[model samples]
Target: MTTAKTFSATSVQASNAATPYFSQPIIITSLEQNIWQQLEQEIVRSLQRLHCSRLQDSTLLLLHKIITNLVKTMHRHAFQRAIEDDLNLDISDKDSIFTELLQNELSMHGDRNIRKFCRANNFQITLIFPEEKDTLIQIEYPTSCNNSAYLDNKLAKAIGFILVKQTHDPSSSYSRAKVVKNTAIQSFRPEQAGYSQLLTQTEELDKAQAIFSQLNHGIVVFSSVGDILAISPAILTLLKLETALPSVHTFTNIIPDHFYNDVLWGLALESQEGLFENYRTRIRLPHNNNLSILFNISGYRHSDTTIHTIWQVVSLDHKATDTLAEGSILNEARVHNITRNYIPQLVEEKAREVVRLGGHTLPNEECQLAILFCDIAGFTTYVENNEQEESVIHTLNLILGKITKAVKKHGGIIDKFMGDCVMALFKEPHKSVLAALEIHKHSYDFNSLRMRASRDLLLLRIGIHWGKVIIGNVGAAGRMDWTTIGDVVNTASRLEKNCYPGAILVSEELYAMVTHAHATDISFSQPFYLKLKGKRNEQMARYVQTEDEPFLHDTVAHSARQHLKTD
Candidate 1:
C-alpha cells in the first residue's frame, strides 16, 4: 500500500503586506489528513505546467499553505451543510461528495478567493477545476482582468490551472513566475493530448460567429488586397439583399461606385498610419432610387495585412415619402414643404447671421433661449373616432396653421412639428409666453366654431421654459438638422404633456424671466409645486393667461386678416 505524504500545519509569513497564513495550527484526524494530502497532490499536479522546479522554496511553501487551507475550509463547509440537511453520507461516497461540494463552492466563491489571495501575495493567478469544464476563476493583481481573454483561455485550458507573471515593481523582492509565450496549461493524460487545443480553436470560431450574427452593425473582414474574407448578416439586411453574397466577393462588388473610392482611401490611410477614420456616405439600393442607406464606416487593423471594416447604419431615409401617411393632415407634400424647403432656408439664414457676427457656427454661444411645446389634447381619440379622413385632415391643418402663425408672429422659429404638436424656440421668454397665450385664444375660437358645427372641440396644452441652450447641427451626415438639445427641451415637453388642456404651463425659471423683464401684465394662476416625471425634486409651475384684453383682440384680428389674405 502507498503511504500519503504528510504536510506540516505550521503557519507561514506572507511574502508581502498580506495577512499571515493560518493564525493557528490546524488540527485534523488521521483520515482527514490523508484526504488533505490527496487534494494537495491533485492541485500540485494540475499546476505542474508552471514548472515546480524553478519556484522558490518560499513560493512552494505558500502554495502548500493555500492548498491546505482551501481543503480544510471546504471540508468544514461541506460537512456543515450535510449536517443541516441530515444527510447520512457513506464513507465510500466521501470523494464524490467532496467533489460535488467543491464544484458548488468554487462556482460561487472561487474567483473571490483568488482575488483575495492575489492581493495578499501581489501576484496574478487563474484556477480551473477539472469537474467544472471550460470555466476559469481568475484574479488580476494591480490591474483589471481581461474578461475576453479569460473566457477564451477558459475553454482552452479545460482541465488545468494558469499562473501569470507578477508585476515588475522594483521595490518588491519576491521571486515571480517567469512570463511564457503560451500560458495555457499543458498537463493532461496521454489519451487527452492536443484535445484541449483543438477544442479551444473550435470554441473561438463559434464564439466569433455567434457575436457577428447578433450584432446590429455590419462587419466585413478584408485581406491586404481588399478581398472580402467575411461579412456579417446585418450587411445583407441593410442593403436589402434577398440572398447572401458568394464567398469570393470583393469590396468593390458590393460598395457603390460613388463611395468605393472614398472607402478605399480611408482604409489605406488607416492601414498606413494605424489611425481610424469614419467615413459617412449614402448608398442607393438597386431599383430603389428614393430609398437610400446612410453608412458610417470605420476600420480596425486585425494584423499587418488584414483590416476589419465596420459599417453602421446611421439613418435610412425614403425621399419620396414622409413620416406621416400620404393623406394625413401633416402629409408628404406639406412635410416636405416645411422640413426640406423651409427649415433648410431658415438654417441657412441663421448660419449667415452667425457669420455676419464673426462666429463660425450658428448659435454657438450659449445664451438664454425659451422653448415652447404645444400639442392638441385627445387628438389620438379624435383620429380614431373620426372616419372622414378628408374632414380630419382639413380640421387638423386649420388648428396647426393657427399655432404656427402665432409662433412666427411672436418672433419664434418653428423648430419641428409632431403629428399633433409643434415645438418652437424664442429668443425671449415673454415672446414664448405670448405665443402660448395667442395659441390658447385661437383654440378657444376654433372650439367655438366647432361647437356650432357640432364637431369635436379641439383643446391645446402648452408649456414654456427658458434656459441656456447651445443650438447647432445635430444628426448623421447626409441628413442633419438644426436643433436645441438640453434638459430645458425635455422639461418643456414634459410640462406640455402633463398640463391640463386649454392651459399654458410656464416653468418657475421662465416665470422668473418674464417677471424680471417687467412683464407684469401676464396673469398667472397660483403656483403649483408638483413632481414631474424624470425629475429628482419637485418643481414649481403656473398656468399663464393674458390680462390685456386689447392685446388678445389685436392678435386675433391680425390672425383673421392673415387667414383672409391666404384665402
Candidate 2:
C-alpha cells in the first residue's frame, strides 16, 4: 500500500528538488554545533529507515550535497561580514569556497555528466583555514564551466537551510538562507560553540529604524476603526507630543472644523473601493496654522474581515514642496535604473545634488514655462448664499475632474487649487495654451449639461502667461515641496484674476507660441493694459474669442453668453 506517509528515497528525491525545499522534521538545534555530523547521520538513518532502494551511496551523496550547499550559501551575507574578522577570510575566497561545494555536491548526484566533465578540467578539492579567532573550512574548485549543475533554485535553498541550522548564533540568527556549489565554509562564536554572533543583525535593524525615524515626514499607523495606532517621530513633532494621541483624543478633536467634513469623513467611504488612496488636503495643526497636508493613506487586512491602515501625513509648506520636487528627480532615477525608462536629463543633476549635499535640494533654471490660472465666476456668492454643501462639492468635483483630464492630456502640471480656482503650468508653452483653450471650450458644454439636468453650473474664467522662471524643489527635509517661483508665475496669477466669466485670456508671451498651431478663428476680444501687483510695468493682456468655436455649439454658446451678460 503506497500510502502518502510511507515515502521512499525516490519519493524523497522528487520532494527535495521541489520549490521551497526543507521538509525534514529535524530541529534547528540538532545541527547547532555540528552541521556535517548531524546532516550525515540524518541522511544515513533516513535511507536505512526507508529501506526501499539499493541506491544507498546516491542517497548519501544527495544528502551531503544539500547540507554542504546550504552552509556555503549562508556564509555570504553582508550581516555575516563581521564574522570574517574571527576567521581572517577574504571576501573573494569565501565566495569561491561556496561555489566549489555546490558544484561538488551536484556532481555527486550524477543526473548530469558534471562529475566526469569536472574531472576532465583537472579540478581538485583543497581544505584551507584562515588564521583567526574561529576555525574556517573550505573546499577549493576551478571555475571554468557551462554546466547545468549550478542553476537550480530548490537545491540552493535546501543547502542554505543546512548551513544556517549548523552555525547557530542567537544574536545573528538568519531567518533566511541560500546554497552555493562545491565550496563550503562554516564559522561559529569563539567562546560559544553552538551559538553564532547575532549582534550585527540587531544593530542593522536598529539602524534602519533610526533612519526612518529621522525623516521629517509624519508617519501614522491606524487600526481597522481608523484610530491612531503607532506614530513616528515626525508625527510626534507635528502633534507637539512626546507620546501618542491622548486617551481622550479622537479624529474630530484634533482635526480642523473647516476640513474635517471635507477630508477625513469624506475619504472613509470612498476608500473601500481601493486601498492606499492619497489625498492632498489642508489641516490646521495645533501650532502650525493653515498648513497644507498631503494625506497618503493605505489599508492592510488584519484578519478575514478587519482591515487596518497607515497614513503618511506631510506638510505642504513651500520649502517642503521644493524638497519634494528634488526627491521626484531621485524617484525618477530609481525608476530609470530598474526599467531603463528615459527620465528628463535633470534627474541625474538632481541626484548629484543629493549626493553632494547628503539630501535633495532645489535647482536653479531659466526656461520659458507657461502658467495658467483659473476660477469659477460667481462661485463664492452661490456657495455662500444658495447651494447645499453636498451639491457644492459634487458640482466642484465634476467641473474639476473634466478640467484636470484636459490638463493631463495636454501635459500641464497642476500647481495648486484655491477654492474654485486652479493653477496649472507647462514646461512647453504651446501645450499650456492649448490646454487652457480646451478648458474654456469645455466649460460651456459642462454648463449646458448642468442646466438641462436642472442644476446651476458656475461660469469659468481663465488666464495664461509664459516666460522664463526658476523651477525646482524647495523646503525643509521631509517637508519639501515642488513648485516654481519668480515674477512669471505671479504675473500669470494676476492675469487670471483680471478675467471675467466665460472668458479666456492669454498674455502675448503665450499667444505667440501657439499662434502657428491654432486655427484662424482665434482672435482678440478686448485689447487692454492691466496693472499688476508686484511688477512696476503695466502688463498688456488680450481676451481670446469664444465665439463660433468648434468645441462650443451654437445653443451652448448662446446660453454661456447670456449667463455672462446676466451676471
Candidate 3:
C-alpha cells in the first residue's frame, strides 16, 4: 500500500461518474490517503485469506461504499462502473472470517511493520468506520490477542467519540446498538443471570404446600393485614363447613368477638420481647347452643412478617386413653372422667377452634415428672420373725407412718404402700432427692427409738429418677386408678431393689440435675449396671447419701478430689 501523502484533500471523491451508486462525498487529506490505501490492502487480503464468495445484500452495499470511497480518496479517480467491476469482494460466516484473518501471512507482515513504524516514526494508526446497517464502529477484537495491539489506538479514539455522542442522546442508534450488545451478552451467559433464586424459592414453596396438604389436621395461614389467605380441607371439616369456601375470607368472619384483634393483632403491636405459651381462648361451636369450646393457644413469631400461632382445642371431657389395663385397682372419679365425657369434648373443641381460626392447634406433650420409691428392707423376715399377727401388723403400720410422713413433707404423692415398701412421686428431682434423703433420716430416727425399746428397728431403702410420665387414669371402663407408667417409674423401682438397708440410690439421669446436692459431701456410688427381676435389659444405678459423709464408691476418689478442688 502507498502512503496517504501521495494524494491531497482536493483529490477526494473523484467518482462523479458513479454518482447514483455513491451519493456520499469522500473527504480526505494526503495523510488520510496513505491510511486508506493500507486499509484497502488489509480488506482485500482478508477476503483472499478466507477464500470467500462475493458479498451481497446490506453487506454488499457497505462493501461497495467502502471500496469506492477508498479508491476515490487514494487514486483521485472519477471512477466509472467498469472500475467497480474490477474490485474483488467476499462473504462468509464470522468463524471462517476469523480463521482466515489469523491464517493470513499479510497480518504477520503487518505486525512487523506496525512495530517498526511505532519505533521509528512514532506513528500509531487506527481504523474507525461503520459496518453495514451500523452507525458506530466497535472494538471487535479481544484485548489479550496478539493482533489486537494494531487496532487499540483507533478503538480507544472511536470509543471516546462514541461515549461523548452518547451523553447527548442515550437512545440514539449508536447507544441502542451498545445496549443490544450488552443484552445479548447477558442472555447468552452460561449461568442464570438474575431469576434463578426466585425460581428455586418458588419450587421450595410449592413442595412445602404439597406436604402441608397431606397433613391429617387443618391449616390456616394469616397475612399481616388480618386477611385469612388460605384454609385447608381438614380445617373446613373441623368447622363443619363446606370445603370450597372462597379464598378471600378475612379473620373477622371466622373468629368470634375480635379474636384476631385481641390475639394476633395485639401480639403484632408488641416488639416481641419474649415467648409465652398456653394462652387460653374459647370458640363458639356450630351445633352446640349452651356451651362454647375451649382451646390452649400458643404462638411463635417466625419473623417480622410472619407469626405462627398454634391453637390446640382442650377436651371438655377427661376420658382415659385405651392403654389402660383391665380389673386393676380403681378410682370411680377417674373412670367416669375417662369413658363418659373427655374424648368427645376434645373433638368438639377442636372442631370449634378450626372453624374460628381456620385450623386446629397443635397439642403440647406431657410435662417432665419425678418418680419416688421406698421399700422396707427385710419385710418378709420381719413378718416371719414377728409371728404374732398383732405384733407384725403394729410394726408394719409404725414403719409405714414414718415413711409416708417424710414423703409428704417433700411434696410427694403416695402411689401405694406395699407390705413393707411405700411408693411415692415428686414433680421435681431436687424435691424428690431431698425427700429421699429426708426419708432415710426419718428411718434412722425411728429405728434409733426402736433400738432403745430393744426391738429390731425398721430399715428403709429409697430410689428416685427424673423423666416424663403420663399422669392420668388407667384400667377398664367400670374400674380405673389414677397412676403413672413410663421408663421413669420402672427405673426408680429397679434402683429401690438394688439398695441395701438404710441405703438411698438414685439414677445417673437424676444426678445430673441434682449435682448441687453431691457437691456438699453428699457423694454418690459409682454407676452400677444391673438387670432387674422382671426386666430383660440391664439398667444403670447410683447410690446417693442422705448423711454428710461419702458412703459409697472408692473408685470415684479422683472425681471426689476434683470436686473438692473446684469447691
Clashing pairs in 1: none
* TM, every model: 0.37, 0.36, 0.34
Q: All models: lDDT?
A: 0.58, 0.51, 0.49
- Candidate 2 ranges beyond 4 A from true positions: 1-359, 473-478, 516-521, 547-567
lDDT of 1: 0.58
Best by lDDT: 1
- What lDDT tens digits, residue by residue, belong to model 2 across residues 74-146? 3223213322553565545347674574456444632122323323333322222222222112223222111
| lDDT computed for candidate 2 | 0.51
Give the C-alpha miss distance for residue 511 in model 3, angstroms. Answer: 0.6
User: Model 1 over residues 334-414: C-alpha lDDT tens digits?
Assistant: 676776645643476666544443345443223367999999988999998885644888888898899989988999888
Per-prediction count of colliding residue pairs? 0, 31, 12
Query: In candidate 3, what are the lDDT values of residues 1-567, reduced to their tens digit?
Result: 233222211222333455622112222221212233334333333323323323112222233233333322222111111123344333322356534642462234422322333223322222333332323222221111112112122332322211111232433211111100111222222365764444488888998777646543344556666566555565455545556755224223646544566556664446554233555555444545344444555554556555565545554322331223221112334676676433333234324533432232322213356787888877787777767644777777777777777777877767765567777876557778777777777777888888998877677778787876644435656765545676788888877766665777777788877784454535577776655567777667677754543544643333433433443
Ordered list by TM-score, greatest first: 1, 2, 3
Better of 1 and 3 by TM-score: 1
